[model samples]
Target: MTDQGLGKDDKTPRTARGERTRRALLAAAAQEFGEKGFHEGSISGITRRAGCALGSFYTYFDTKDDIFRALVADMSGQVRDYVSPRIAEARDGIDAERIGLLSFLEFARSHKELYRIIDESEFVDAAAYRAHYENTAARVATRLAKAAERGEVRPDVEEVHAWAIMGMNVFLGLRYGIWDDSRPADEIAAIANALIEKGIGTRPD
Candidate 1:
């Protein structure tokens, strides 16, 4: 896949050192935007936080909006990278869904600023915001379709089911991971997974 994490006009970093510097800038941007927001976040602030010279900023990013857009895409990839391996460890399709939710909660707790950056992206970079969710839902849909082929889930499972699960996980992360973490992540995942196993309707009508 193309590095959507880079600015539209920016080229990929060549040397290992260049790659490290670029990653450092992205990390700093996350904290900058997470605390002050896109409108208030400054290039100088990111450079200072990254421990790089102000001139170094121009080498990686063209403008503040460019970095902010890149940050949103970067964070989206971070979440997927963290959770994908755990999801792969699941024994079956349903268990994979459960593992996915549990990993996401853990990630949210550790990266509290995730919500701030992603939520603000809706206004600062609408395209990146929509792409984030759309890409995630597509992954879920692909998984569900594979499970159907394996006879691990209902044959009729489709894209609608993928989006439904995504919606449930997003809100659950906000409520349990951001608002509060008094509840156990595994416990929450188990409760949600049952809905996948058994329809929530009064009967399978």
Candidate 2:
């Protein structure tokens, strides 16, 4: 994960050491919640995992709920940070989607706890749960719009198309990334890219 602050609500660390401490706490929180879940997880577990004093946790977060909320946002940002640049290297809109899913599958395989933590947020923090997917779909919509402007995709692409593609990627990650790892990331991405190419790609013939 990036060495960045969790979110606006999180007490932004001032010093480099403080930033490191904050990142450690967030990483620890991911593990704590990822394995034991929100209810079973404790601040002590997080502090212990982080190898920091109890006071260090509170220096950045006020309560368990505060930290959990921050952690959700942090994880969401982590996905965006990991995937965006790779997508930028794509040859065009369709290839961008392929790269996006490929990177996401790779990220999910490594961060195996990501799906569990995000899934639990629906009950633990509904607002953050909604924001995660909504923001993701918005990014897809924006990408599709840009692609249409570039004549890479159908001119009629809209919000619903974005949601459909986002939904497909989410499930594909769950099945191929979390449930199994035998399949190559590019193989899965290629299959999905085919659908996008047929559904939306602009035709020259």
What are the per-model numbers of colliding residue pairs? 0, 0
For candidate 2, what is the total of clashing residue pairs?
Answer: 0
Give a tens-digit lDDT track for model 1, residues 66-175: 88988999999999999999999999999999999999999998898999999998998899999999999999999999999999999999999999999999999999
User: How far does residue 130 in candidate 1 sit from its true spot (Å)?
Assistant: 0.8
TM-scores of the candidates in the order shown? 0.92, 0.92
Against the unseen true structure, what C-alpha lDDT does each candidate score?
A: 0.91, 0.93
**What root-mean-square deviation over C-alphas does model 1 reach?**
3.9
Which one is best on TM-score?
1
lDDT of residue 109 for candidate 2: 98
Cα displacement (angstroms), candidate 1, residue 16, comes to: 1.0
Number of the predicted model whose lDDT against the real structure is largest: 2
Candidate 1: regions farther than 4 A off:
1-10, 201-205
